[model samples]
Target chain A: MFGLEKKDARLLILVAVLVAFAPFILNPFPEGSGLAQFNAGYPDLMQRFVIFGIFAIGFNILFGLTGYLSFGHAAFLGVGSYAAMWMMKLLTMNVIPGIVVSVIVAGVFSLAVGWISLRRSGIYFSILTLAFAQMSYSLAYSVLTPLTGGETGLQPKITDPRILDAALAPGATPKANLFGLEMGSSVELGMGSWLFTFNAGYYVAAIVMLVAFYMSIRIFRSPFGMMLRAVKSNQQRLNYTGLNTKPYTLAAFVISGMYAGLAGGLMVAMDTQVGAERMFWTASGEVVLMTILGGVGTLIGPVLGAGAIKYMENILSKINSDILHTWFAFLPDGLEDFVVTLIYPFIGKGWHLTLGLIFMAVVIFLPGGLVEGGQKIAKLFKRKSPVDDSPDGKTTPAE
Target chain B: MGILEVKNVGKRFGGLQALGDVNLSIAENSVHAIIGPNGAGKSTLLNCLVGKLIPDTGSVMFDGQSVLGRKPYEINQMGISRVFQTPEIFGDLSVMENMMIPCFAKRDGSFKPNVFINMLKDREIVERAEHMLEEMNMSDKRHMHAASMSRGDKRRLEIGMCLSQEPRLLLLDEPTAGMARADTNNTIDLLKQIKEERNITIAIIEHDMHVVFSLAERITVLAQGTPLVEDTPDNIKGHPKVREAYLGETQEAA
Candidate 1:
């Protein structure tokens, strides 16, 4: 069946339950515990995890299915953010309008870019998209200062009116309120000394992420997705067989762009700010990294990559030399010092180097990333392994 | 009346002339086979016809309408469908999914954007696809991933994809070029069935003489980017110029 299977439906429900309980799971430390350096319970970073998960998932739709590597996806995110901010400034702070505007604007932008880029295939298409994104980034930084607010970015100001809620002052900050339901408010559950807090905002973002996830699953199952895969495998054959694969590829590109825009809009809703830096090529590269790290074509892979990278960025960076020294105090004083210093380069700003090394290692050895590794391990546990390197029983050409 | 007319089509790549002053007229509902030695511009002519390459000077007409400067998909929408030399089925998708795509394209003029609605419930599209697969004897492999199938099966699935569209004109490029003896025989039988059942004009470029004789009503021999002879398949086999142009040294014996 082209629709979700029973197992898939069950898996989705399990994932939803886990996401709903993320705040409680992450906020496990005692209130004033001195060892509470790794707190992933915060709303800001949780929103980031889900939003970028959406971005990487969208990117995988284009690159994974079509084999068209785009290096300019950040431009879509930036455009979406700007569109969302404009919605906040003009209309209500309600996220519905903001998300709608973001998706529409991003889709239009992707259509224009896809039309020109599709004129050429392979590396030329990649370079063209990169050039377009760079052009957009520069325009946002300088020429379009009024709309983008230049390097300062567009932010909520004290004087901005809150038309939806008159009780709030004109200068007051806008919260993500859905029909008078406060987004920032949390539900606290206590059992003796133990406590758990779940923010309404995180749940909202989680729900949106789930919807995005479901939509992606549907797209992957549709006939349209099949055409995109055909285009990737053999364009000449597709053409000769009477299929015009261009429109199909363009459709995929637009759908992905809309997803990226939705992610950007959610980001702005969570943070109340949109920055020009979001459009940088490095941001674009990060999404690619996430997709590849988890597994490019796999369904749940990008989410894992997003969570892993974001967790490392937030938690691992906080581990200073002092904390390391305390953990290894049982060993000799000088040996502990040597060990901490030895691992110091890989923990903070050096984290990216570790990621790069890991990426290269994965590319060289496990080209299919974590998904393939997991499959291989599963095969090892089972006595009978498949005949070929392909995880599924197919003779597909390697990328 | 010329259902498809190519007038004064000339294509050049820098200094090399791929096609020069080439003209062709396709009668409606006729199976036309274009045969040639290697590098006789057979592929270039097909490319020009399908809007893949723009000729330096030429106009291509389909159903008395200009086909030049139109996008390939737009041309497909105008009742033209193509099948490549190699099988081009979606590797990840099942055989049924591949068939359903062209059925969608045929039923709906453009793509349907209501992605939220489940596609499996669309019984009409499914039934059409099933019928096409049955026509190709591929209904048994409907749930199998296309990439996992044998070469013969893959070709069958691809043919089913094109047939689902129900195009007025079908283009095939070297459809039987790489098949084994058994597969070739199977393909010959498949082509015979397709021509008999579909009632559509098929324009094919084939290196296989067996395939050409199997389905093609008329045959055109090309040499050095020009049509040397166009006649019935039986006449083409006996024609002196076609033998001389295609067989080379064997022309004296003929």
Candidate 2:
């Protein structure tokens, strides 16, 4: 409906349905059950999924369409976080103002970075972005310590002036909210053995993510999106075709940066803190990993990739050797130890190693990421039919 | 005054003089061909005109405006469009999408706030692109990936794309350089049709004598980075200096 093709509209509706039902679906196991650990319906984790989804969606606009692999988007995210934290410190605890400030701040910051980095293409452009991001991170760590809160990080304190809202009841701590709706508040509904907990913050974040996704869909189907794809397809031809590609690219970069900022603002709204570590180059690398792992250019690929990585990072990392032992207890003593040892490097603190292996597998086999894998499955089903099914109506479905 | 004026334009790269004190005045609505051997600065001079390579000395003026330091896209916006030797269409896009880019550029100038408008819903752009493709006889291949097309089709699509921009000046760098005879003749006919219908200026850099002589009303022969002769096709074919520069290459070529 929002400038989307029929297929694109269908995709948007599918995503909306999925996001709406996530809390119920993810929290299928009842509370206090052994499988509850896998329940991703928790407000904190659920919030991360949508926030990072926003980040990845924005990144796809730049990298997927324009083919500009920025290595410094985390800097924008960090800038957004810092802006949100300051907004909370200076203004009211209304998450709305904080979110707005973060997007604007990140947009401006990315504009300066993109203006300089877009001067070069290929790896040189990536390195230029990396240099700018690292500079921001280092500056936040030391030189800009007073503003950034240095080694500690920025946090809203009760003593600091909050001019917008009524003076807080003297000794109360500041809490991020939408008007007066507490972000941390949740409603838990239990039916028989299954318990579903939906947090206000996660729903808010999910709604924002839906809007971000809808906007991306509009962009992907727009003439502007065609220009961006054109930029990636043949920039030389585009220049000859009389398009100044710099503006198109710069606009993409800033838009992606604003998305990063939105993600950052959401993170602080949920957690109420800003850290210099968020600006680290490794953080930028994480987004790249998510995009590539899920399918670099596809609509739902980044979100799926982000969910997979975040799930592994938060859930699998929590599984210690003791849990492995409990699961393998039925085996003989020697076999149990052997099995635990074998699976040890793929979970718990070694979760990153598992992530790396999975990433490598995705890159080597399904270079289009998990979206390609899904397409392959769809193709197999179509092949079983009598009609020669053009899966997704293209030779390559995911790209 | 001609529509395009090159006055003492020279470009030196290290010790090599790519172009030296080159002077030419191309009239409006004329077909001008620049022919030279390899490394004779034919490409260098063309690059200078399109602002791809800034000449080390002298000036190039198109439509009475200096084009010395303008960017390639900026030069294009000044109503000059170039078709590359290797057919530079967007391989990742469909043929229709490839044609629409130039149409969009022409209608919206160099840049537009076209982000929010649905491409499929842009009836004007879609019709314009479809009409251009129909004229190129590529209407059926409109939805095919541009990169998958035959070389002849690719060249045709590129020319169609350039023409869709409705440029005042069309620069063709060996439009039929690597084509079979059939495809070459097709390209020639296409150019003829375009010429009759558009009333636009064409400056082509070509190596084929037959193709050059058949199409060019006036020819500029370049040798060692300088214009050797500028004359009518009949005179160029018979002139001793032109033959001397050609070194009997045309006879053997024929």
Candidate 3:
């Protein structure tokens, strides 16, 4: 059972199945149809799903269990991407070094920040983290421009010496690879108007995400997780019970930072690009939004939230007036224009408005997030379930 | 030597002296009760003993080590556990989880980052916690949420949690405060049983004379940030000095 409890092991299997078949599930539309634009089975978007999922999962380790809401987590992600980009530039295009370097760099950076920021809890802790992140972003943009490539971003170049990699096939640009397998390599299968892409990059990210999810489950059930939860619940009691809570919390913060770094590294491995804007404060807020919208403390909630937000950003934002006009073409001429105008604000440019409304609804109605919604549904089913032919099939909601 | 010794401990805030020239010695394996009206510095003295407050002058020695400026967790590691006035149990955890935290602290020392180890398989810790729950008669409430329990139950769980750490000295700050008569008597019995069955010292600060007389072997009366008298419980009842200081009676001519 991989050292997991029966319940956790079952959950892992279910997630594995879901993640493995996501390309098929997300691409229900035909390629030539009007709805083809909504397909998320493409390599670029699929890689994003797994990458951001890792980011949110890592954030949950700190914020969910320990109740420390970090507003500067994106700094770690940005630092990670920058590190990965440098690894690819200076070393080989092999992503292992890039990933390893990013995780290590982000861990060290987070340790420094967590050490200082963790001195205070609640609002002060949040402000200190925010300040640290802003400092990192400012440094990356201005002072560290040589290292970070300034506003243009650090990108891989053909002239750089990739010590581990042999001379490339003549006149070819570098791409991230695992051994000899190119990360951008993909296999496209088409049946009639239906098209599905199985990308080597997407699979790598998915496998990494699966491992990260499994590790998160282990942490969630470990005695260490109990201690983290104790830190969240009553740190005073823990301290009095002869436990130093600061170190435990710092470990969580560092772990969360490393997760962000892994996500960042994966992003580069897929797109082979790293931008300073990824480390911006708003980007940090986006991960926070993902974790909260999914469910603050639940294991699968953050991944679900990350996927939801990314999908909305990618798919919903593509709905321009042209798409709206086509949908409303069946209506009368005056009503068709009116409907398109009415729907214009929330799609494309105003997708943030839709996302904001969803975030608010999750916070207000489902404080426990999407996980709580699932639990409520499960509870309802449990209440309605009847006994199986036990002389009398007498089971009502009252029981 | 006393298990806990406080010599001339004084704490001042701006213009007021919260604790002034306070000296106390709690002998090993004895129950000592500190009784005072509000603002008489009983709680202040208790805070000093646990390292929550550092006295401006004087030393607090527990088991021959200076407890001054040590963190509360360090103080607890030296075999002193405190039960708070408001029942400070972890509200987000289950009753069993709450019970096991002190066990982890005691067995693993002050800190260990033992992450990735399955807690469900921790056999020794589980048995110890279950045994403690059985002693507290809370075995049925093991899976219950600690926060959802009644106040009396919370107090019971908190006390049980303190005992599981196996501290040499237990400090109770108004253990029976704000409880109904029935719950108060239950707590009294629990304390009486603990004192008889274990080789542990106890220091209790209380406003209730009933609880003080029931458990205290020696009683110290405080008034205006100083000890007025120290005597046995029986003699402390009608002692004229104690009567005048505690009851606000005018002293008659000697």
Candidate 4:
């Protein structure tokens, strides 16, 4: 209905419903229950789920379509965060300007990086991008200290002269806001023993994520997207067909970079803080993991992947030996101790081991990622249902 | 005067002289064949014409414009389309998608960020692609992946992709290379049809005498990095120098 085909429109609506009801869906367990530790309905984690989803969606435009694996996307994200912080510190506490500036700044930065890095493709292209990201990280950590606030990063301060915003009270601290509504403010609903918390910032970010997703779907179905796929498929044929591969690849890179920047700006809008660690190589790698884990080219895969990883990162790491021991306390002393010890490495501080094993399994068994798995399951159900075939065992006629 | 003119074009790589003092002109709306033995510089000459290589001491001109410094895509934009030895269609895309790409390139030029417009809704591109597929007799396989098609069908699709652009000149590099006899015959028939129907110049590099004699109105015999003879098919077959350089051994074997 939104200028999308029926299939794509359905998918978009499904995602919108899921995101809108995430607070209730994520917090399934009642308050003070034993399983409450697994609840992921917190506003902070929900924001991250959508933010990283945007990052991976953008990355997919480059890696999935154009087949350019950029290892330096985090540099754009970091630059975006720093730009948003400076805007907040100087202009006002309002997030609209900060977010807008963040995208533009990141676009310019990525344009320069893409122009240089796109010269060499394949492994050389990957290494060039990696080198650029590392250089940016180093500059932010050391040489560009005055601008980036060095390794310490930047934040809004009461003493700073905010040209567009009024002075803060003597005893009050600055908070990032949209108009008069603070990002951290939330509404709580208590029904019997179950409790649901909904935050203003989470809804704001969710709306942005929905728009980003809709735009990505349009791009995937557009003529430009087909060209990007051509660039990936047979660049030589494309060149001989009178199409320039350089500009197409460069445009994809810059568009993806701008997506990463928007994600970075959103992070500051939600938290009112910026850090150089946001641009770390591992952060860049995490987006790649999310994309591959969900499904590289599918529209909804990145968001699912981001949610899966963030859920595991938050909930799995919270499980300790004590929690494990309590679950097995009914067993004898020695048996409980042994079980706790055996499971300890896979949880808490060693949760990465579990994540790594899951990643390996996804790459091996589900090469097309979780989306393929879901499709297989859907096919199984469709096969079981032969009601559509006919009442007398004859198949339906072809249209 | 011909549409394409190669004047004293010479190219060398290290100690090996790939092409030397080559001069040729391909007339408009004619099927021209370049026949040669292995390492005879036919491919090298073709590469020089398509902007893949710059000549050491000559000019390759198409329609009175020098094509030396231009990129391959720019050269293509100037009304030249090339088909590779192996069918070079986008293997991962569907047959319809492969045809639409060139149509888009023709309509939108080298690069256009029509990122928001729906491809299916773009009536011009869709109609052109569908018409070309129908013209190529592949409308039934429109949704099938291009890579899964047979070798003959792949070659047909590639030729259709080239024709969809309606370039002034079409270059075919060993169009029937590594094909079964039936597929080769099918390709020759397709090329013959293309030549008859379109007012386009066709330059083909081939090892098969059957294909050359069937399609080429004028023949150029190249041997050891130079043109040994350029004449009509009947005259080329009777030329003593052409027989010595290439045709004699093949005629004896046949």
Candidate 5:
């Protein structure tokens, strides 16, 4: 319902096409590709892109649409993951049960958190949500260890049940199935030089992600989304106009929580693991970063952001001093060592520094993020020839 | 009997008495104007009527039903809509989308979960909003963002949004609060047009004497949280009590 702009609908279709064949487009330089580690084509990483995309999309419903900054939404994601893991452990080894459980748990959790936190507005509301998330995190780590599995996390063990699938034993060790379909199944294509492996779990995650993305589009175009925006722009006016914005805000919050839950469920389905770390405040902060980095209100922006951040996390961490030395082996011995040493800090743990700088630059220069930047750059080239002769034309603003 | 009635409405915010013994009645399809100085409890009285504040000791009846503790949306559903002092159009939404909201509310009287369906397919709503915008002479700017419009145009859009709901009573809190002379006159003309075209009762709180004198049939003067005088617009301009309470020395010499 997100009043889909004509441009946005076309963008969505383009994104869908890109995601459909990412494996080949992303891995063009297959032989000794330096970007292979950063490739979003791998099933594990692809699952992550979709899952976090769902997470950021949900976060946008509240923070983007309603202008309510929630610092505690990660708790819902973490809770969803834990709930999914529990479903895998106690109910069935199928991802369906995990997904259902995750959604319900997240919905209930958001209802409680939103009810209390929404009582306050602005920073106070943010702080309240933060406090609730921290409480959930603490409880998951220690107080609720029996149910949450504590610091060790709720990993799938040999004793887990698999009710639906007759082939998977009652004591199977972490088997993740979708319905009755095995997630481990994969198809290998092409000769030895060009191998493409298609994993079932990755496709499952992709399908779910697409559904969630479509749902968000609907919400944005709905009358409800309009009301939420009105609440954000002028809450007092809505109150006077005879509309109680509380229920609307709460609905947005709940919808966002469910999205986080779906992401959490898919995460466990891909890896069959859920940890207390998922609910950490930094994880919540990361989703906010994804939405902001991509373009908070833009539907596809968050998905692009999630992929970028995750790629950095995975690939950037692998570029150590040894890898650098391997790349610059032909250089002089001293020069190679110097170059490797210089690049060492920024490659691994220091990658976060680069990300932080990028975030800062975006917030300062491109407050509307990538969307505004792209529009400006497009306008710059589009009008350069005609506007070069006119002073007034150059002064004209895009906004 | 009055279509809407307020009896002995009183409210105190800690040390300040915002309203004290405020009483009024509104007949169906009549324009009622509430005028006062800055701290005259005019807005506080409106807040009480719309259920924004619970009056300490009084009751507000809308269409013969008590609206004292009802929620704002409930009040709206029961046929009352309000326009704020500063225009409160949905800043990001286009002009037409803003108008469609109240129309949806009026048609459904309940929220429908039709996120994917093309909302513009509702011909009735589209026609009604188009006609209302045409009346305001804002039909050309239908697709423009509400935030991009001028201050006067934004007010017109806000009034149109409220009117689209087809409320039985429209409460306006200083609809011409911050407009230039020409813009204020334009707003006055727009309001006069709406009154003539729609069968809706209107209660406006105004600081502008020009706006009040142009449209108000009856005027109630509020001073220090109490009604100084309630009379016809002609009588209100000449009332000695009103001049001392509000117009002060400037109008007295006239």
Candidate 6:
């Protein structure tokens, strides 16, 4: 339909359906229900799901295709956020300019970083990127204090002159918007005990995520993408075949960096703030984890991984000891206490322990990641369905 | 005047003079072979021709253009393609993809960021790749992974990839190294066919006398970083100096 192969087009439609109906899909539990704490339908968390999905999808283009792992990807995201913040603070509250400028600024920054770092490959390249990200993080935290707002971070303020925007009312606060539609504004739909909240910002981010995903699909099928894969397969052979590997790798790095920047811009548009912590090495590592966990080379794997990680970060971390105790209150007091204590560490702030275990399990049993797991399950079901036909076909074939 | 001219090319590796005062010319549309023992500098000279090594004392020219300072891909774009000792195909890619990459490289030059053009939809590239795969007799294995293919198949694919580019000069470094007898014979036949079918210059560095005698029109015998003799394969075979320096050693080794 969109100049895509049949299978890819179907996958895109399926994802579009999933994203468009995410509020309902993610909020399966009704309000005040015991499982309501696990619901991820709220505007803030929903925005993050799509935003990081964009980030991981971009990361996949580099790490998946070219096998160039940039541990400094989040630096581009941070740069984008800062750029978007400045755009909102000075130019306008509308997000179009902020997002556009963020992508361009991040592309330029990544070009410089990629040019130098791509000279090395394998582990050295990874470490070089890590060093660049750390440097950017440290600089933004300290030396670039005036520009980055240092430890305080940056926020749109009333005192700042917004040249492209109308003057704020006497005491009104600046809110990020899309042509006057406030990002945070949401419409609530209540049906009996279930309440679904659809936020303007979440929809905006989701649409952007869809576009990014489509573009990634296009790239995956492109001649350029084939060359990138060739780079990963055998760079020496590629060079000998009259195709330069340097420019291809550099282009992938910059394109992925721009994707990260788009994600960072979306984050600011949703929340209206920028922080240096976003550029931390851990944030960069998170995107890598997401890409590997979902599926390294598969097109939709990164998005699934991003959604899984972000969903866990929000829902699992929100499960405090109090909630655990309440859920187990039906058991005898001592038994309930024992159960809660045993399960407590894996939930709430200790969610990382659970995530770590899941990551290990995925890597060990499903090296192809969650996508492989899904495919295996699908195969199992298909095999079961053909059981009746298989016996008859076997006997008839023998005859 | 030959397609490739190597004159007084010397490469030193610190205290070791790998290639010293070598002069050779490979004529257009001819198969030339370089035969040497373990450290006879055959590979070094091949490397110098393909831009992998810079000669300290000579000019390596291709079609009147200096190929000394250019990068490997640049040299390749200038109508020269190299096949490695080990069949250097993209193992992870499918056979058809391996064939298509060279076609893309041939069409796009060193680098072209045409990121939006669908590879499968690019009829020109697909047709050319299909044609090459057919020519290589690997049409059925197009969907199979390149790594999973047998060694002979990989070598065939690599040679096919080089040929798809229609390179004016094709350089092979031990093209049939580490192959079974049957596979070695198959490769020889393929090379013979390629020679008869294409107007391409082939420069081969081989350790096997059988392959050289069957394929090379002219032979250059090198002994310790210098060519001892260069002549028609039949003449070179009968030369006393060639027999003592190269053929006699192989005869004894046998």
lDDT of 2 at B57: 91
Model 3 chain A: worst 10 consecutive residues (lDDT sum): A390-399
User: Cα-based RMSD of the predictions, in order?
Assistant: 4.0, 2.2, 4.5, 4.2, 4.2, 4.7
Interface DockQ per candidate: 0.27, 0.60, 0.49, 0.49, 0.31, 0.49
What digit string (tens of lDDT, one per residue) describes model 5 on residues B1-254? 66789899999999999998988988788899999988999999998988778899988999989998888878888888888898887776668877777777677654454556555666887888898788778988887777889999999999888888878999999999888878999999989988998898999999888788899988899999998888899999888888878977535432
Off by over 4 Å in 4: A384-399, B252-254
lDDT (Cα, tens digit) per residue for candidate 6, span A198-315: 9999999999999999999989888898888888889999999998899999999999999999999999999998889999999999999999899887888899999899988989
Model 6 Cα interface RMS deviation (Å) = 7.4
* Chain B TM-score, candidates in order: 0.95, 0.98, 0.96, 0.98, 0.95, 0.98
lDDT of 5 by residue, A253-313 (tens): 9999899888888888888877888888899889989888877776667787788788788
TM-score of each: 0.86, 0.96, 0.96, 0.96, 0.91, 0.96
Better-scoring candidate (lDDT), 4 or 6:
6
Model 3, runs deviating above 4 Å: A384-399, B247-254
> What lDDT would each prediction earn against the true structure?
0.79, 0.89, 0.89, 0.89, 0.80, 0.91
TM-score for model 6? 0.96
lDDT of 4 at A212: 92
| Candidate 2 lDDT, A225-308, residue by residue in tens | 889888988999999888989899999999999999999999999889998999999999999999989888788889999999
Q: How close to the true structure is residue A196 of candidate 2, measured as C-alpha lDDT?
A: 83
Q: What is the interface RMSD of candidate 2, in Å?
A: 2.4
Candidate 6 achieves a global lDDT of 0.91
lDDT by residue (tens digit), candidate 3, B116-204? 77886899999999999999999988877788798888999999999999999999999988988899999999999999999999999
**Candidate 5 error regions (>4 Å):** A1-9, A33-36, A165-174, A179-181, A189-195, A326-342, A377-399, B250-254
- Which candidate wins on lDDT? 6
